[model samples]
Target: WHWPTAWCHMFLAPLFAATGLLLRLLLRLLLDLHALFFLPHREAEGFKEQGNAFYIKKDYEEAFNYYTKAIDMCPKNASYYGNRAATLMMLYRYREALEDAQQSVRLDNSFMKGHLREGKCHLSLGNAMAARRCFQKVLELEPDNGQAQQELKNAEAILEYERMAEIGFEKRDFRMVSFPFLRCVMRPLTAASFRQISAPLSGFLLSSPRSDILRMDSTNADALYVRGLCLYYEDCIDKAVQFFVQALRMAPDHDKARLACRNAKALKAKKEEGNKAFKEGSYEAAYELYSEALTIDPNNIKTNAKLYCNRATVGSKLKKLDQAIEDCSKAIKLDETYIKAYLRRAQCYMDTEQYEEAVRDYEKVYQTEKTKEHKHLLKNAQLELKKSKRKDYYKVLGVDKNATEEEIKKAYRKRALLHHPDRHSSATPEVQKEEEKKFKEVGEAFSVLSDPKKKSRYDSGQDLEDDGMNMGDFDANNIFKAFFGGPGGFSFEASGPGNFFFQFG
Candidate 1:
């Protein structure tokens, strides 16, 4: 029985060893399959290493390319997809990055990074609604996403602007006509949000899919361009120009960068031209150039006000009193605190004999005046107003108050010949209208004063006292008969042989 047991043990021991080896091999095979199908560990590791190197060098395009390769190798890897989407966003390819981010979240719905990336992508694409959804998802997953909370707030603000625009349009408010659609759409993006989104998105959009191409890497060029634009808006023109030039050197085909450079140059040239004209005493020319500059950039407050003030000066010099007033009015409209416009307009009104208007303009200037020159201008305007108000109509017409009818007629005709609308046919429409009104008033004044009966009635206190008298009480026909004498007043009768008309009245 002992010998039989020993033989069984030897046979069973080999069988057991074989069984154990087989189980070990099966476990190894399953582990390898898991790594291969779900992770692609080796390929992903290689791509990740390459991506890290590129990212360190700020070469976002190359980084994005490697990250994308890593994602392709490990299709279910949320980290790889999230990283790649981040790189793409750097290139300004927000729409494409958004897809990748969405894919990452679809694969790994619990990944907070994926949701954050998706929200950022949506923000770049001006999809505030989608972005808010992703941000909300991030908050739900990680409740401590401060960045997401801020972004959501920004998106809400932009949405509000769009809503306001829609309301304005529905209400037919023409004042809101200049609101840009993109401005309304991206109202949520503050300067801080712009800096955050643009920096990454620029790199992603300009980068090539191939990781090895250095020339195709647009990270540096895009960064320079974005920084330049920010500087430009911040009023750092020289620094902005430098960045723009550097961006052009890095990427010559960059249209937006080139445009920024050109605009900066044009603005500088326009400013220089206007300054030159102003220095040379060509106020009108200076004003025109400044106006053109303002047209190019309506936000240029200095140029807008400068052009208006300069134009006012030119109008004043040209004796275009109304035009001077208008120019000053525009200046004040652009800058309500502009004391110069009020002073200039006051001067213009005084010149035009509009004493009441001049007084009002002077009072406004006095209230707002800060400089000594402004105060002096206000004082001068007040003095001029007093002088203009005291002007005698007879002195204006260059005739005595009791001038003969013939003298008044002669004076009126002479004045009308010089100040008639036809005489100023070459003037602007506004100027012509003003001159016409003035001439009409002058003619009417002359007509009333030249009429003996009307003049007598005007001189007496009776005409002023008769407040309830109608036009029928005047009896102008009787007045004319009394002035000319007889029924056929001043008739021409040919002295013939015999014509005796005897009236027994």
Candidate 2:
């Protein structure tokens, strides 16, 4: 805050330039010392010194040409081969680097740097076992080498990480974090250069399943702890820590989980406080606390749903139905079977006069649980569904509600010809089923409009004219069976297993 923003940027830029320049100079000086000490074939050594200078100057092509000249003059120098291998690796010519490294080791088996170079080449080629043996051999020669130890550890970790990464890839369709999946190390992460001659593959990666990393059940301490461990193994440390902390806070006596919890930054205190504010009707305060909790562990499905649903409830109280429905939908996506999401969405649908959508929502709830209350609510929904379906008979026939009998008759005949089952003999079974229903609807529309008494009743929403004097002895059940031919003719089981084609309109 003390320094101006413009000044801070200006200050950092030049400092970075100076630091880079200093590094380059230091490297050039070191390479010069190596060339001076290497006294075999003065002309060849001079050429290698030029190569080393060019290498430090970031001109790999020039360095490679000079190194090639040095190798031609003095084919017996292990250091020249090793230096060339290092340059080839920088240029991403890994197989060429491996050949140089092999020559270097062949020239001088005792040369530790030559072996190290070969090990790096093997590692780059994804030859982990070969790389391991090279590192092990270095250890046999020099038992106390720290770089060798760290390199060995990293090679093992690479193997483990790759195995785990593959497992994750198989389980889902996703790339990985860019760091090469940290920033690509000095030694590239991949075993070899990746190439493709086909079309350019390009697309945005979809959002990952964040909910899998989190836990929302405050009472289930053991469950939360177990879930955290699962996430930790999957390399999601940040989310894992959140669950672990919550689990430990709830079950303090759970010694093993508590130990793991100690390793994590906890979210239990804020969440509990948020829950308290919610119950006490301090919604704004609750919102603030939950917001902070979400910042720490946004992926916790249950926790996130609770936050969304709670906010939605407040929005609902304020008559902000649209906002409430949006939040509820978000919660549902996170946890598909979230009962509260279904209930809230159903209420929104009802408020908006989307009776068919409400019926569908209620059907989902009924499938999940069939409590007495749900049964009562479902019956009410069923009634509403029938009324809604039959509410627009005039519209189905493409006639106004106030249209005369002649107009109604003309509209019905037109729609009948367009949607008749025989006209759509080559249509899909589902389409045919819909057409048959529409034909029945059109006939009913004509029946209502033809008679003043029934038309008055239909317009008032006082009747659903399933049966009327349209066609003589027109069996509705026969029409239903013609499409869905089964033992139960037109069985209106809303949630039946064999009800795939049932639109329930």
Candidate 3:
């Protein structure tokens, strides 16, 4: 029994030894395989070395990718961030580059290359004040840095010129709005005139400091944005938008310029829409669009006045005469020399039979407008006012301008019966009041026409102007409707005594 136990023990010990060696070899092979699949070939420094190689070759895009990997691996490494920022600048990704440059400086404040890259990034972003500080810091760390000194000088020059341009824009641009009278006077001028007007700035354009900054450093976002504002004010909209977009591309943080760009685009689109609707004779739609334009750009006085005048024209077409007159008056008040407003209001007054008021408005137009059509309109208004002042007693009585005394009497009696207030007593109170006023008008006309001398004076256009009518107090539209035959036609001549229901109040 002891010998057999010794044999089993010896075989078991050998078997266990062989199994342990095989297991050890298997474990070692698995560890090597795992490392091959999952472990990196190098650390952040190695990745940055590759990035540097690409950067030296000027393959910025490839360099940026490698540097991004280095940053992901060792976020605390200032040199990694600094190198990546340099690559991003080469790629024209200034905003992204600026962030990296700032972080690189923050991680290791004494890293001179980080500070140098940070200064360049700030300069590119148009932060001249910040760039100056960074370059000053670089000089503190390394006193005789020629590159930093040159950049500092450039930043100072840019800052100074930007200050001067802003001052000029503020002082000179305001004069454009203050003189509304000059807007119409300048409208006939071509783009060449605008260029000539901006010729004062033309020197600025030829040696544009802002433009110079952009040319030297395409990522000067603030300088680019300021130039966009100047161009926008000059009415160079497309060029303005281009500059604004480039500014935003370089610096996403430029909120003020972004908002201005959006509003300018919206205003331009809405004006075009308004013009299209007006041309299509969709006056109602056009009016709403013009109203939107005014609301969007109320500060542009010349544009707002033109919008008001156009809306007034639509109001006239829509039969909103009073509102049209009100709008036209506002437009004329804004630009007193606006001949179109005067013409529009004059025509409205003529339609309402306020010939004296029409004459005044027409006279204003004639003073500004030398067109033959306006001159003829002025003549008509003057003639109508002369005829209106005499109170056309014969026309008021619905008798022929040459009717005999007996016929005038008969016509008066007929009109009196037709317009008696009692006949309208069952109608609305407003109608009844109008009927009473009209009855008085008829009675006054009858009294004058029956008197031979007064009648002759009224006919000869020399009657008393005060006692008969103040045209505004009457509903001339209703009177015209009634005097015309069947709501369709009427002669300029006073018709024979008809069943006239002259509206008055």
The whole-model lDDT of each prediction reads 0.66, 0.66, 0.70
Cα RMSD to native, each candidate? 30.2, 27.1, 26.3
* Best prediction by lDDT: 3
**Model 2 misplaced regions, further than 4 Å:** 1-266, 388-505
Tell me the spans in candidate 3 whose CA falls farther than 4 Å from its real position: 1-254, 354-357, 393-395, 398-413, 416-505
lDDT per residue for candidate 2 within 1-505, as digits (tens), equals: 7568789788998999999999999999998886765554788989999999999998988999999999988899999999999999887667789899889989998878777878878877667668788888778888898888877766666665455444444555223321122212223343231100000100111133453223233466755665564454333557778777787778878775665554334455676777798789887777677667655544244556666776677667657788878888877865678888888888887776677878887888989998888777666766666667644776777876578777876786577656666555567999999988777776656666667877776665565335443344465334334434543543222245422222222
Ten contiguous residues with the weakest lDDT in model 3: 177-186
Error of 2 at 483 (Å): 49
Which candidate has the highest TM-score of all?
3
lDDT of 1 by residue, 1-505 (tens): 8998999898999999999999999999999898877567787879988998998888998998898788778777888888888887766556677788888899899989999989877766557678788889989987887998887887776565556555555554422311423243234343334433332332332342542212433456765675565566544667778888998998999887887788777876786797798789887787678667756644434345656776777778767678778878877865678877777887788777787887787777677666787677666666655544432446646888678778877777566555555456667999899877666655555645666665565444234226543433343333333434555543322245333222211
In candidate 3, the residue pairs with backbone N, CA or C atoms under 3 Å apart (3 or more residues apart, or in different chains) clash, namely none
Put down candidate 3 lDDT per residue, 262-307, tens digits, no spaces: 8668767887898899899998998899889867644334455677
Which stretch of 10 consecutive residues in model 1 shows the poorest summed lDDT?
Answer: 496-505
Q: Cα deviation of 80 in candidate 1 (Å)?
A: 1.3
Question: Candidate 3: deviation at residue 316, Å?
Answer: 0.9
For each candidate, what TM-score against the reference? 0.37, 0.31, 0.38
Error of 1 at 221 (Å): 29
Shift of residue 29 alpha carbon in model 2, Å: 63
